[model samples]
Structure formats: structure tokens, C-alpha cells
Target chain A: MASTGAVTFWRSAGMTYNAYSNICAAIVRNCLKEPYKSEAVTRETVHFTTTNWENGIQGKPVTHEIFK
Target chain B: MAMAAMRREGRRLMVISPTVSLNSTNAVRSPLVSQELSLQGTRSISTQIVRTRMKSVKNIQKITKAMKMVAASKLRGVQVRTEQSRGLWQPFSALLGDIPSMDVKRNIVITVSSDKGLCGGINTTSVKVSKAINRMNSGPEKETKYVILGEKGKVQLMRDSKKDIEVTISEIQKNPLNYTQVSCLADDILKNIEFDALKIVFNKFQSVVQFLPTVATILSPECVDAASETGGKLEGLNSYEIEGGDSKKEILQNLTEFQFSCVMFNAVLENSCSELGARVSAMDSSSRNAGDMLDRLTLAYNRTRQASITTELSEIISGAAALTG
Candidate 1:
């Protein structure tokens, strides 16, 4: 959720927030291992899934700064 | 009156000689000429049909040629980008792989494919990889869930694993896909009920000629703990230490979340590259086939025309011979 300038999110023409969050939510669930689904873990995931990330996702290809 | 008759005879002879030459050649040379006599009425229609067919084949070749060029250029762009971003996810996956899991019950798989067809068997291969993963693990019903990211994969899974498909995402192929397109899927994943681990089935772009379906697993921290706890060689675990309170768990969770997205993003890119490469080769072959078809059609057209000419000559020469004899 931090503005690390690493991840930039951009939505296409008609993509809904619910749809976007659903994908993020799926990623979190798939990555979250069992027993680690603790209260703290749930809270951390809620932060990433339900935020305004439309500022930047760098949809373009990155070749120069890849090594940096 | 005699002079006028002589002139008329010369004119008649001029037309008669060509007919005689044509019929005699067919009669003396091959039986293929006799068959032309029976088919004389259909020659015009068949030749017209052949011309239209050749035109359509030429048009299709043009389209395929354009597609191949576009796919090749797109492949070049994505391949380099995927290679650059490879470093972001490779280490995390390596660390996760070494870690073992305690609960291997719930399996969540993301099948990466493109919405577009005509790309060989890229989508089919991904679905097969997913099915193979399910079979290998012997995943139980309702326990193994699927998130399909492309229309082609969704259609394939809908028939058999319809119940297992939890979510389907689209619009990636509408533009050049990037991490942002993947973030939407990642966001959906974070809101899930529960899962032990995650796996993504994608087509790995081996080369222009070979694309192998691949699956990459995203491990949870519990699995990592399970590995280190069971003495699965915590070789480099002690090196990185967390000093803060619950932030330690929080940080690890965040890292895993980010890494998970990165892995998903990488898979999408790899799959896109494979799709384009497969299409490039697919179109290449199709265009080549069209060319071969055009060649065959042209040869047939020429043969049909020659036969029609032979039939005309046979008619003319026989008429002339009857008149003289």
C-alpha cells in the first residue's frame, strides 16, 4: 500500500473496482498459506486488496531499469 | 463468280487448319483429350470457380502474413521485458520452493492464456497443464479452485471443470499486457476465503518453434515455516532478520503478497510471448499452405483450359474433314 513507486496500477476502459479487487483478492488467497491466515495476516491483505491503485501500474514494458 | 468462290474457299481453309491440328494432337497423344469432349460444357464454369478460389487464397495469405509480422514484433517487445523482470520473481520462487507445506488440501490455480484464438494450442496446452496438476495432486472436488484469466481458457474449463472455475478475467489481450493487468487479478486473489497454496499454469515460451506448458507455485509463509521446522535446510534463513513486533509477520505477509503478484505477472508475460510466438509460427505455416494451394489451383486451371482448347479443335477439325471428304 505504500507509495514505493515500484507498482503502478492503471485500469482499462471499462474495468470495475470490484473486478480489480477480486483479482487482487484471488492473488492474496492463493499466496496465503494455511495457519498464517491469522488476524494480522487478514488485516495486511485487506490493505492491499481494497485501495485506490489507479495512479500507476507501468503497463508498458521495462527494459532499461530492469537491472537497476 | 469463280473468283469470289476461290476467295471464300481460302478464308474457310484458314480457320479449318487450326481445328485439324488441335484434334489430331489430342487423338494421337493421350486419352486425357477424350474426357475433355464430355466436359466441354462445364469448362467455363470450372475455370471461373478456380479463379475465385485463387483470389480468396491470396487474400487469406495476406491476412496471415500481417498477423505473423505483428506477432513477431510483439514477441520481441514482451520477451525482453519478461527477461528483465525475471529477476524479481525467480528468487522468491526459489525460496518458497525449498519451504515445505503443512496443509496441502486447498489448491488454487490460475490458468494464464490469451483471449485470441488462431495461436496454435497455447490455451489448450495451459488447460491441459492445469488438469495435469489436478491429477498429479489428486485434488478433491470443490477443494481445487480455478481462476481463468483468458476467454479461451475459460471456455475450455467451463465444459469439464465448470464448478471449479471461481473467477474469469478478460481484456488483457486488448492491449500490450503489463503488471497492471496482472494487479487486477492479484487484487481479486487477496480477497479469497482460504487456500493452502497457489499455482499458475502458463505456456513457457521456449522458442518460436517450441512452447512448453509450465506451472509455477506460490508458497505461503506457513509452508516456509513447515520447511524450516522440519529441518528442510534453513540454509540462508538466519541471514535475514526482522527486528520489529507484529511487523515481522506483517512484513513477511506483504513480501509474499508482492512476490505472489510478481510471479503472476511474470507468468502472464511469458504466456503472452508464447501466444504471439505460436501465432507467428502458426500463421507462417498457414500462409505457406495457402501458397501451395494457389499453385495447385493454377496448375489445374491451366490443365482445364488446355482441355477445352483440345475439345474445340476436335469439333472444328471433324467438321472440316466431313466437308472435304
Candidate 2:
């Protein structure tokens, strides 16, 4: 649960990630449309938890470069 | 992948350099235009661009703040729905957990994600997990199929596991999420798909700043029967006697349908909560960043103005001294 102060803080911030997530997600369905403009914003949302043991991001961040 | 990225970068540079070359050609050809490029003019232009940037950043901050509030407002309501829906599916999943692993003949992984993106890496994490699971299921006659909900999951999965996708649902989270819509999907899956194991990948809302992509399995009928036969968490299920001998199939079908919908609804709710939480935090950070940028821009604007004023004052002083001399 977010505090009242935090909620107030949020009332002043930027765009919802949901809107961007939606447009990106619809890339496949969009391909079904005419004159396909390859609308792929290839920015990764989050890094995966580490599977590799050495020189790997571990613990807090948990970013693993799998299938790279 | 890195090599491919480098090639793509080089291609981009190739595309961009032509414009740079064109600009240089124009500059060389036009002596009149070149004379207009004075230091004061450039300084004023820089200040103007910075001011406009600051204005845009301020506007972005306003938008982020508003989005955060909207997400915060939706959070409580969605959280309530999640709780209510979880109650509907918890027992069946708890029963499914008592069963041991088996050589799965068929498995379908359902990833529930929202259409929106700004909520950090909420959808990507679940998609990655689904991909990892798909990799494990890869063999002679790959038994794992994916039922991806929302645009985020669909687009990400389409990259690697395109062939494995069984069903893709788009425009899901447009309105308020409801049970009937989810149950309709559940019915479609139950009717069309053949599966021995059902795995749901969803973003679990832990806190305002944290979300965990989780996979929860909804056991198939075979597993349920096997577990019940061994009397593992089957006491409650066994107590309810069948009304008729022939209706066992019908009863199971209805139960499976209901259970599937319940589980799906719960997952959808969880994903929604996580998205809202993620959006709120992401927006918060964006607002802070915009503020920081505004601060830097203001500092630069003031410095440029001061330097221009000082330059003008020095010129005025030198002209007066020459006139007096």
C-alpha cells in the first residue's frame, strides 16, 4: 500500500508504462494491417534473474543475459 | 546479437551521414548564410532551445505525475478484485500443488500481461520465463504451447516462440477487467486445446516498488485424479458425492471450466495490480528525472544570459573609454 504522501507525489509524475506496453504488444496484430510500418520499440522492460555463475549480475538486480 | 546490433548501428550511421554531408555542402556554397552565424546569435539560439526543452520537460513531469495519481487511484480497487478472485481459485491450486511431477504429455503456458509498457519490465519478465519454459519443453514433438494474453506478451513471444503460440488475445485490459471475459477465454481454451498441464505466468504485485514474475500451474484432470486417488488434499473433493453416474464427465467439465476461469481471473487481477504498482513507481522516477533536467536547463539558461550581458557590458565600457580618449 502506498502512503498518502507517495500518492500525492505520483499525481505529479510522467506517462503510464501501460500505454507504451500496449502499443508494443500489438505489433503482431498490427502486422495483419495494411502497409506494415515495423513498429517495434525494442527496449527490454526488465532483465532476467541470473542463471550464470561468473561475471553475472546477481542478488539485488538479478539480471542474466540468457539467449543473447 | 552484439555483432548484428553493431551492423544495424553502422547502417543507421550510413543513413544519417548523408544529411550531415548535405549540410556541409550548403554551408560551403552559401557565404551570406555563413556570415549570419555570429557567437551572440548562436548563444541566444542555444538559450531558446534550452528554454523550449525545459518547457517540454515540465509538461512531461505534469503528465507523469497525473499518470501516477491515476494508477494510485486504480490500485485499491484492483487489489480488492485480486483478493476476491484469488479466493475463488486458491483451493484448487493448493490441491494441484500436492501432486508430484510426471512426464507431461501436453502443456500450455499462459502468460497474462497488460497492454501497457511504462510499468518497467513487468511484461518482459513473464515473457522471458515463458520462453525459458518453452526451451525446456523443446524436444521431439514439442508438447508446450503458449496462450498469451495482452499485446506485451504476444509481441515479445512472437520473436522466439512464434511457432509455439496456440492463442493470442489482444485489447484485453481496455476496460475494467471482469470474470466473464476471462471465463469466456477459459472456455475457449478448454474446448480447443489439449493439455495435461496448465502453467500461468503473471506479474505478482509484492509492493509499490517491487513486482515478481511468477508461474503458477493449474493441474490437468489426470494429475487431479492421480492425487485424489492417493488421498492427497482430496478429502474435500471426495465428500461431494456425484448426483448421477453419467454426469461425472459433465461435472468434471463444468468444474474444470469454473476452476480454469477462477485461476485466470486471479492471474489477470494480479498482473493488473503489478502493472499499476510498476506504473506508479516508473512515473514517479520519470517526474524526478524531469525535475532534475529542468534544474540543469534553468542553470544553463541563467549562465548563458549572464555571459551575454557581461559581453554587452564589456563592449559598452570599451566604446566609452575609446570615445573619452
Candidate 3:
């Protein structure tokens, strides 16, 4: 209730507090030194595979990788 | 007649090949062979059962050994991350401070559990603690709702406390855990539920073999304001001077949201590490049990085979003596 006028600049920019904080975390993670930075980055990566099924037939599997 | 009986015996032995022994059903069907061979057929059946049981135990042992190795390696990674993630939330607690115990009308219990089971009693312990909290906190004026994170807890709490569960989030442990992902989840939870106080229940990783179910509280900003007004207990806030005077409430709101995310992030990491460590030990015990079972089964199978072989040798010696007489 006390948060009316005190909304951060990011809140005014249409970002929920969640998104703003996540961005902040991402920045901090990027700024980490050397091996930790590399490990953090690697920890954020996600690689997944999917296959399309049309009717009863099979399809080739497609792999997608996410690096953040 | 003697020749015919010997030929029948010879044919029966030929049919009892290794391949036939593999199908224990062949021995089961041997009652149709003749009455005299029934005893031998049952003996072979028991031995075959023991052999197959041993094979299954061996396979299970292999699986558990592999699982133990996998959990150990995964524990190393999560344990490191959990240590680093602790830094994320410790500052917030130091700044906002812990209220210790707060009596609020509405409470949300965020139950952190794992997606997959077979780890240990980590999920059970969390569920038990959460249930106890609910039991203690329930009253006519007070209400408690559960926000279950992970499938295992949902399945458990659904049995008795299904009505108390507000939201069930799954697939969290499917991918590698990270801040961004957890933050997003926290945001969604904030939007979905409204509560005066949040009590996060998770297994705190103590060591490779030790994990304790811990409950950490995060007071909503409204509750924080009320607590400050009633008791003026937020002396920690007085220590820090704010640069922008008008934005104090805004900062608190953002900080609250950020704190929620940080605490949730750390809880998730800690719970995961505990799960992996629990898995390592559980799989290790499982493998050990399988080994013991294999040993017993091998002994039983060997004894049965030896007994059957001795019976055949004696029968052959008697037949030779009788023929000579």
C-alpha cells in the first residue's frame, strides 16, 4: 500500500518486478570474475530436443540450445 | 521295458537343455511328461527361478551403482551452486531482517520438493513439516494455503490436504536451475497468490549425509509495515540511510520482490543439492542390498544344482550294479 509513488523506474517501463530483478541478476551473473563467470554462464545454458509427430508417422528430431 | 524306460530318461535329459532351462515354464509344463520325472522337474524349476532372480538382482545392482555415480557428480555441481546462491539471499535477510514469528491472517507455505523420487525421505520430511505447520497455524481467523513446487510434494499433499493447495508448479527440475528461471517462477507465484506472510519449506543441505527440513519466512511489505508500526522492531532499516527520500516505499517494494526471488532461488538450489546427496546415499544402500541378495540367490541356486546332480549320479551307479547282478 505504501508503494504507490515509490515504484522503481523499471516498473514504469511496463516490466514486472520479477522481470526487473531477473535482469539485475543476469547483469550480476555476467559481471562475475573468470571461472565463476564461465560456470554461471554454463549453468544457464539449456539444450533440449523435440520431434514433430504428424498423424501416426515419425519425424526427425530437432535439438535446440539456449545460451543466456 | 527296461530299454524303453532308459530311452525315455535319455530323451528327457536332452529336452532339459540350457535353452529349455531358460524358460522355467518348460519345467512347469513337465507334469504332462510323466509322474516319475515330476520330482526332477520341480527341482530344476526351483533352481531356474533362483538363477533368474539372481540375474534380475544383478541388473538392479548395476542400475543402482550407475545412479549413485550420477548423483555424486550432480551433487558436486549443485553443492557448489548452492554455496554461491546463499550469497544472493543472505544480504536481503541482513537488510530486511527476520521477524522470527509473525501472526498474520493469511499465510502461504511454499513447499519445495523434487520432480523425481527415489532420492530419499527429503520430500517426505518437507511434507511432514509443512503439515505440522498447517496444523499448528490453522484457526478460525487464520488461513493457510500451500504453493507446491515440484510434483512429488503435490502428489503427497493432494491425498489429505488437496483443498489447501493453491498452486502446483512442475517441470522445474527438468532443466538446469538458474536465477532467471527461478525469478520468473517467483514472479508468477506472486501474481497468483496473495498472502501476508510466506513460509518456504525446504531441505537445507548440511553435508553429504545430512539434510534438515528448514522453514524460512518472508514477510510481505504490508506485514513489514504493520510490524514496524506496532513494535518499531525494524531497527535494522534505521541503520541504512536512503538517498532518495520519496522513493523509500518503492525501494522497499522492489527489495521485497527481489528478496522473495533470492530466497526462492536459494531454497531451490539447497533442496536440489539435498536431493542429489540423498540420492547418492539411497542408491548406495540399494546397490549394497542388491549385492547381498545376489549372494544369497547364488548360494541357493548352487545348492539346488548340486543336489540334483548327486541324485542323478547315484541313480546311474545303482542301475549299473543292478544290471550286473
> Could you tell me the lDDT of residue A53 within candidate 2?
16
Q: lDDT by residue for model 1 over B58-127, one digit each (tens)?
A: 9999999999999999889889987787887888866655232334777778899888899999999899
**Candidate number of the best TM-score:** 3
DockQ score, prediction 1:
0.04
TM-scores of chain A in all candidate models: 0.33, 0.23, 0.55
Instruction: Work out the TM-score per prediction.
Output: 0.70, 0.68, 0.79
Q: Model 3: per-residue lDDT, tens digit, B1-325?
A: 9999999999878876643564555664344334435565564445666777899999999999999999999999899999999898888887787664788889888899998999989999999999988887789999998888877987898788877877677767778887777777787777657888899999999998999899888988777766655656675574567786555566666778889989998999999999999999999999999999998888888888888888778767866775586
Q: Per-residue lDDT for B172-278 in model 2, tens only?
A: 56556655455555655665677877888898878878887877776666556655666746545656677644243334434555577777878888999999999
List, residue by residue over A11-60, the lDDT tens digit for candidate 1: 22333343545457556755766775453233322211111111222123
- Cα deviation at B208, candidate 1, in Å, is 0.9
Rank the candidate models, highest DockQ first.
3, 1, 2
Q: DockQ of candidates 1 onward, in order?
A: 0.04, 0.01, 0.19
For candidate 2, the docking band is incorrect
Categorize the docking of model 3.
incorrect
